[model samples]
Each structure stands twice: as structure tokens, then as C-alpha cells.
Target: MTMKTSFAFALAGLALVVLALAPLVLPDYWTGVLLGMTGYVTLATAWALFSGPTRYVSLATVAFFGVGAYTVAVLNEVMPYPLVLLCAAGIGMTMALLVGLSTLRLAGVYFVIFTFGLAELVRQTVSWWEVNVTYTMGRYVFLPFEGRHIYWQLLVLAAVTLLISWAIGRSRIGLALKALGDDETVAAHAGVDVTRIKLLLFVISATIITLVGAIQAPRWTYIEPSIVFNPTVSFMTLIMALLGGAMRLWGPLVGAVPLFLLFEWLSVSFPDHFSIILGLLFILIVFVMPNGVLAKFDDLRKGNRA
Candidate 1:
């Protein structure tokens, strides 16, 4: 490996070590917060894996995440936790494959709208099933495990996501995706196999996202369609990726950690205005630093030198 790749792997290893040890040292509240943050960070990174390189602004995260959560919620009673988790991942991959094949060809605003609408479609379908067939508002899940167990699981998953993203960013496939993002027609003309790569990345990304939802579902004890399929979840994932620099492997982590903390603070201190504050911040970022906070900093340094 080259120096940069080696350094990135080292950094990822160090981060994993720290995350693994964090719950041991943290208080209950802090551990819970970290668990949530790690989950979002993982989701954001998974999102960046496909969307960043492809420049596809997908809002389908909620669909996959909700599918994972619901799959576990429904199957946990009949199967072991590990089995449920695996099944959830499979279901998520299937959903991604179907959705990506059908909608990946749509470009620009149409693609975004289709994804957003797909999430709502799934949410409504689940809601209808719950009310008409199950006659329940939500499913009850038994979580006999401690908080730290979930925390460790999430930490490991997040670490793996970081590693995978870093590897992809440096691989030949990464080049194709980057090229695809620049111009899909050119990438295809250059023999990049655009369709296959897009679908594969979509499935891979969905699998990781579902794994997170399945692993974390037990911590919630109860999950409703509306709760799991909330648009805010997808929105936050997108925001984190954008704010940190979606093209960079570390972007999701950089975005998720601080933004999650800020969200927690706002929810606690000014619950009524939390959304407003977050929305304004998002708008400000879009207008002033569309390339991301880190990019903006680099630009400022370059200007200073000039």
C-alpha cells in the first residue's frame, strides 16, 4: 500500500480501538448518545458510498433502514438475533436491488423525487398492513441485552463501514464511480459498466444500512412504521454526508459526530426550535459551503496563501 492508504488504514484501526473502549469509560447517558451517533455515522457513510461517487442524491435511506428495523421487529420472535440480523440485511439488499434497477436510470430531480416517494410508499404500505391485518400500531421487540452490547455492535459496524468506504475510495471501482459522477455518458463510453456498478453500490450500501437497523432495533423495544420510516432519518443522513464532504471517506464521521451532538443539545435545551435551528444550519451550509465545511476551510487557507 502507498503511504496515504497505509495511514488511512492506521487511522481507521485507531478509531475502532477508541470506539470499542469508549462505552467502558462512558456514563450511561453518554454511552446511549454515542450509540446513536455511531448509528447515524454508519448510515451516512453507507449513503456516501453510493451517492457520493455516483452523485445520486438518494432519499431512500429511510426505506432501507425501516425495512431492516421492521424485518427484525417481525422476525426477532421466531429467530435468533443473529439470524434476524442476517435476514434483515438480505431483505434490505433485495429492496435496494429492485429500487435501484427501476429508479437508477432516472436523473436529477426525478431521481430524488422517486426515492423520496418510495420511502413514503413503503411507510404507508407498512402502516396499512399494521392497521388492517395486524390490528396493531407497532410491533413489540424483546431486547434482553444491555446498552453496552448494542453500543459495541454499532461501533464495530461503524468501523467496518469506515474501512469499506476508505477502500472503495482508493480502488478501481472508485475511479469508475467518480468518473460516472462526472459524466455518466462519458463513463459508459469509457467502458465503466455504469449500470452494474450503480446497482452493486446501491445494494452494498443498503445492506450496511439494514444491518445497522437490525442490530439496533432490539434497543428500541418497539417500532412503528411511522417511527422507523421517518423522513427525518434520511434527511439527517444526507445532511451529514453533505456537511462533511461526501466524496471523502471521513466525511460522514466528521459530519455525524458534531451534528448529532448539536441535535442532542438542541433537543434538550430548545426542543421546540430544534428543527428550525437545524434547518437554518443546513440552509446556511448549502449556501455558503456547498462543497462542505472541510473544503471551505481548505479554500480559505489557499486564499490566505494567495
Candidate 2:
């Protein structure tokens, strides 16, 4: 409606068009890099959708992600690819619903610890099932999709996620979430249906994350619990979301791109020290830009205007 809003939407649309055509023009190596970047963009954005508003700080990203990948690995042989994705979403939503109902009541560090533990629990469970029942440590994924296809799918997912996040930010539920973030007691007193709001957003976030994992599974070709359900995925997503200013719709995108590039470089240049550097970066972000780069920038802009 407003000129600024119309201009922003136009710019976003142009960026999306350019990104969608990226695979055709980009070299193989760069395309691969872009694919990975897009994966994180989707993950971080989805993570922020729930965590940013409610300030829940969930670490269960990999649980749902691994479930999605594993779902594809197990059922791709028997079911259609689209059906497998749907199943992954369904499983993710169910898991999130159960977990949210039980743990959303817990706040601060307790919620954080439980979510981290939940990912580990899912990983261990999958590992046990493979070892005892399947008699295999990992499953191979055989699909017709290539890196470009996966990249496109992730790109689309990321776009949809951004759109959904933006839409939610403009809705009544978004206000409820923000109020919940500020003070759960006050929000409930104000008739916000706190539990329902948190659970709904959490499930939506988890389902998107699951779909991301399913879309990306074929790229791995071989997925084990450890590989698919790596804890680093959870941490990286959290760091990115926080770094970008999780409270803002486009904050995760800002954080994910730069941090993903930094991680890529660190992984290659200092493979042994990569984890240490990641930990250090996380500490630095928490101390230096706890409200995220976007918030910091906004603060400076306001100060200048004043």
C-alpha cells in the first residue's frame, strides 16, 4: 500500500528471480556453495519464526531435520518423493506438537537444555534402531534429483519461509507472540492463549525445517544419524538467527549468509579448529551483538536521527 512497502516487495521479488536463475549461470562449485547457503537460510529463518517471537531458544532443529532426512532415506524406496516429503512434514509437526506441549511450559535455560537434549535423544534413538533392527549404520538415498534441483527447492522454501514470516509479523498472532516474548504472564492475562500461539508457531517452524532436510537429503546420498542429526546444525542455526536479529523478519537472512560463508572458510582453512572458532564466534555474538546486527544498526540510525 505504502510506497516504501511496495518498493521493498519489488526488491525482494527481483532478488528471488535472480536467485532462482543462479544455478544455470553459476559454476558447479559455487552452485554447491549456494545450495548449502540456501539450506541454512531456510533453517535459520524457520528457527527464528518461533524462537525469535517467543524467545524460546530451541535447539531441536536437527531432531526434526534428521527425522525428515531419515524419512526420505527409509521411505524413498517404497513411496513417492512428494509423499515422503509430506510424511516428513507430518512427523515433524507431530513431534513439535508433543514437544511444545510438554516443554513450552519451561522457560529460559531449562527449555534450552531440553531442546538440545531432545536432538541428542532423537539421534541416539535412530542410531539404536539402525544398529539393532535395521542392522545398518546408515542408509543410502537414491533419488533423481541433482544439486541444482535441491538448490532450487531450498531457494523456494526459503522464499516461502520469508514470506510466511513477514505475513505473521503483520497478523494478530504475531502481536500475541511478541507479547508472549516480552512477558508470558502478562500475555496470558491479556487473553493471548499463550500455549496455543507458541505451539502453533513451533509446529509450523519445525515442519518447514523438516521439509528443508527432506529436500536436502539427496545431496548427501548416504545419511547416518550422526551425519544428518549433527548438533552443529542446531548451534549454527541458533547463532545465525541471533546474529541477524531474530526479532526481525529478514534478520536470519542477514546473519545466515555471512556466518555461513565464514563457516565455510573456517572449515576449509582450519578444519581442526573450526569448532573452536565457531564457539568463539558464538560467544562474541552474544556479548557484542546480543540483539543482532539489525537491531544494533537500527539503534545507531535512531541515535543519528535524534
Candidate 2 lDDT, 163-249, residue by residue in tens: 999999989998888888899999999999988998899999999999999999999999889899988999999999999999999
Cα lDDT for residue 238, model 2? 95
Per-model CA lDDT versus the true structure = 0.87, 0.92
RMSD of each: 1.7, 1.6
Clashing pairs in 1: none
Clashing pairs in 2: none
Assess candidate 2 and give its TM-score to the true structure: 0.97
Error of 1 at 287 (Å): 0.6
| Model 1 misplaced stretches (Cα beyond 4 Å) | 304-306
The list of candidate 2 runs beyond 4 A from truth reads 304-306
RMSD of 2: 1.6
Q: Write the per-residue lDDT of candidate 1 for residues 286-306, one digit (tens) a residue.
A: 987687777777888889622
